[model samples]
Target: MRRSGFLSLVLASALAVPSLACAADHVTGALKGTNGAVHGIVDVTGAPKGVLLRLQVQGLTPGWHGIHFHEKGSCAPPKFTSAGAHVHAATPVVHGLLNADANDAGDLPNLYVAADGTATVELYSTLVSLKGGNNLPALMDADGASVVIHAKPDDYQTQPIGGSGDRVACAVLH
Candidate 1:
């Protein structure tokens, strides 16, 4: 109605646009297992170095579990073979956090579940990219990616999954 009120409204709408755009830069996944499910969210806004991953999972074994981003976004129940291997950016490397040469882009820290079989964790990854920059593999590629939870902890020194046991849970990221 008034010029001052119209200008204020315009300014407020303009300020809200960036936050709305940032919210669109996020991806979500629903991790499912035989017993329970987990909700995963990845925020790629302002990812100058990396992305932020937030996860809330239930019905675990109450111990350490290895987590990674699989190369494919297909999550088949039971085995999850459709999810493929861990994501690699440039070249094939060893699977370990302490490797001297290199580690898989999808390699991540262990997730610990409490006695109640619930875990809420936030993690950051600097290897892969959401916008597909710096020669890194994009999580939103043609094949996409999946977040996988293993049955055992990664020793960070062994080859090919670092002694991580069977795939317990998986969520295809879009």
Candidate 2:
């Protein structure tokens, strides 16, 4: 089978298998840019020990960009600061995916955009949940969470945003 077909089969299986005690197995939403444009779509599913994400987006700068799960689900345009910081525990809250003492569950790897200004990628996080469980924070909590895209790439070892620049696009995980 083609790669896309195979991936569809895999994703279908994943969506069907996991059963969370509360809430649906997954959540999906649209991505909007700071300029108030719809860029793409996002699908988030509850996985065995974590969460799975599949995203397809366009109109980027065609390079590496930082992506993360933010503390708040609000994606107020212009400046996504309303989304708050990374979704992290109250303690052990050091940033950077490469940090030894790292405890920020919202940290994710850099997302690469094609020369055509589009990106299609799958990511998994072993630190969060959909409706909140396993002592991990919930991406779909009372206030909710969001997937934010940055202007620059994440160094993965730097503090905070890793110089990822501005928050360009956001998708609230409702």
Candidate 3:
């Protein structure tokens, strides 16, 4: 009886650990930019080393658009500055690459809209997390941030922030 009870307790503890870990591993949110008519959804899987963001978008202008994390997640008018600033986890502010060190935390690859004006993008960045050395603005702790769709592709290198044009739409991540 003692052996059976011990084994059962061990198994139960193992199962419980995984259930908690799985719950902590998942992060999700939505995207709403200036292009009010269309909206997108974002699902993020956070790992110890990196986080994968899978984005599905529709109702865009049908071309190259910048996808990034803005300063604030507020999605306010005239320039959603509330999302705060770019994430640029490793980007030191000199290198001009989305995955580079100087890049903002939100600097992601350019998103392409299909002829139908719909698009989907998947990206992974280690720059998101609370436990890791790298941390993104959008976490459960704060209001997080919004994923913004730019009117133009980010030029990759611009002063202060990327040359990504005005925000067409934004989605606030809770």
Model 2, which residues run further than 4 Å from truth? Answer: 1-23
Q: How much is 17 displaced in model 3, in angstroms? A: 5.6
lDDT of model 3 at position 124: 78
Q: Could you report the Cα RMSD, in angstroms, for every candidate shown? A: 2.1, 8.2, 4.1
What TM-score, computed on C-alpha atoms, does each candidate reach?
A: 0.91, 0.85, 0.74
User: How well does candidate 1 score on lDDT at residue 113?
Assistant: 86
**Model 3 / residue 142 / CA error / Å:** 3.1
In candidate 1, position 25 carries an lDDT of 64
Residue by residue across 23-140, what tens digits does model 2's lDDT show?
A: 5778887899998899999889987688999999999889999999999988999998999999997764677888788888999899999999999999999989887888888888
Candidate order (TM-score): 1, 2, 3
- Residue-wise C-alpha lDDT for candidate 1, range 10-86, written one tens digit per residue: 99999999999887567778888845445343333327676777888877788999998889989887788899999
The local lDDT score (0 to 100) that residue 27 gets in candidate 1 is 79
By lDDT, the best candidate is 2
Winner of 1 and 3 under TM-score: 1
Candidate 3: stretches off by over 4 Å: 1-17, 88-95, 98-103, 130-143
